[model samples]
Target: MVVVKSVSRHADVASATSELHMESGQIIRYVAPMTLDCAEMNEHQQVVMLAQEKRLLFGDVSEEAEKWAGVSDLCQAMDHIVEIEKETELFKGKRILEVGFCTGLPSVYALEHGAVEATLVCTDNDALNNYIKPTIRKNNVGKLVNYITCDIEQLREKFETNKFDIILAPELVNTKPEYFEQMHDMLKLALAHNGMIFFSGRTHYNSCDGSMSAMLDLMKSKKCFDIMERSTFNNSVRNETAPRKVVQLMHKMC
Candidate 1:
């Protein structure tokens, strides 16, 4: 059993207790959603509520989400880690580079399991310093993580070539061709030969629109990455607003 200590900026914020049942026979204690109305909650409180809701729906299997409970897409994050672990031992002794705002769950999980080190790249310094850094320290993986606040284009200037064995990009893929092109260049520059990249996001705004197919086409034309594995799962059970299908794309640098 693990209890994630709540770290909130609001002094008057009330903490609600909840239990997350994991498949590994571990239970994590986390803050449940407050009874306050959404209109009354501040921005920070609302973000916390959304995270707690995700943890409840997803069962907090990794004990990573609740520690830094905020604006992370918990469903996709959990699915990405679970699918990767189900297939490979990629985390063992490997260096990880996590791009985009994933709430640092993947990086923390990597260090806890066996990864030598991890670098988390995000444009938000406030989120990195306030939420992610504290959570990393609480999880006792602070020394293994290096947080950087920079745009995706700055990655090449910040690190040497082939710096990461695995690159995690959750909720970074979109329907835009230019977006795909930018991400493809960044992945090729940072990822080592034979390294893997995980790109995951919702299939559409509200319904499946085959946007993933278009994105995959762009990826295939790059020639630098080979599609290794792809899978999709439904998010309708927990999220009724959009309830869209989510896709996970695993690519290996050739």
Candidate 2:
């Protein structure tokens, strides 16, 4: 099995406990979402792809997203992310939406790293935002960088189809897969012409599962969507993880 590095983390809520003192540089506590730490952070190095190498060398934040909660091994999945960034037209300077903005890792990284400009409407089910200290520290207490604490299905009213440059569905297999279809419909409404949508999952989530190929085909069948890029990475987090089997995909409205 390949090895991925272990990310450092603490279990007690960083700021909510009220007993812990925060560092001056460290943003105060964040309202972490109720996201499951699905897979352990793989500290081991697998293979670095082109963009992966660049991001790691540059210390890009999205590459570091997997580390905050010990959920992903960015090193193993670098190829997929890099390809999505490079090939997808959806990632640059456009209004973007994040479906599961749990740790704010990828979402903030996307903003900081050029995936989008202006503000991104990030949505999550985390209830910590009301008392979220980091947002205060970041001065997003209630404006600009927005976060919605509602489920994707419930917040359909917040977005208009074809109104955004991009819409992203992160690794949501652990949640309801039906949301993917809804995202597709919403992206059509939310994304501009020639805009893009990125959808991802670890694969085989339900009993009636769809492979990456099947999912892409399904998207095509529904509308004229073009696949800008498709790639796979490793999941060497544990003995049970499939070797070189993680999949990531990017799509555009054709």
**Strongest candidate by lDDT:** 1
For model 2, the stretches where C-alpha displacement exceeds 4 angstroms are: 1-11, 16-92, 115-144, 149-157, 177-179, 206-214, 232-254
> Per-residue lDDT for 154 in model 2?
52
For model 2 the TM-score comes to 0.53
Once fitted onto the true fold, the runs of candidate 1 whose alpha carbons sit more than 4 angstroms away are: 1-22, 25-88, 159-162, 174-177, 206-211, 229-254
Error of 1 at 25 (Å): 4.2
Superposed by TM-score, candidate 1 places the C-alpha of residue 249 at a distance from the truth, in angstroms, of 6.0
Tens-place lDDT per residue, model 2, 1-254, is: 22223333345443332211111111122333222232323443223223333343344524223322222322223323544444433345766565532444344434433554333344422334432335334533233255555555656666643255655545433344455576556655655675556555433322224334455556777764666543343333233221213333344423
lDDT of 1 at 146: 84
Q: Where is model 1 poorest over a 10-residue stretch in terms of lDDT?
A: 30-39
Report the lDDT tens digits of candidate 1 across residue range 1-254. 11234434442332233333433332233222221121223566545545544555454422333223221333234434555456436578889888743556667666655789998887766556545565566567778888777665566686664478878765554334457777767777787765777655544322123244566677788766667444333334333232222333344533
Error of 1 at 246 (Å): 6.7
TM-scores of all predicted structures: 0.63, 0.53
By summed lDDT, which 10 consecutive residues of candidate 2 come out lowest? 18-27
The model with the greatest TM-score is: 1
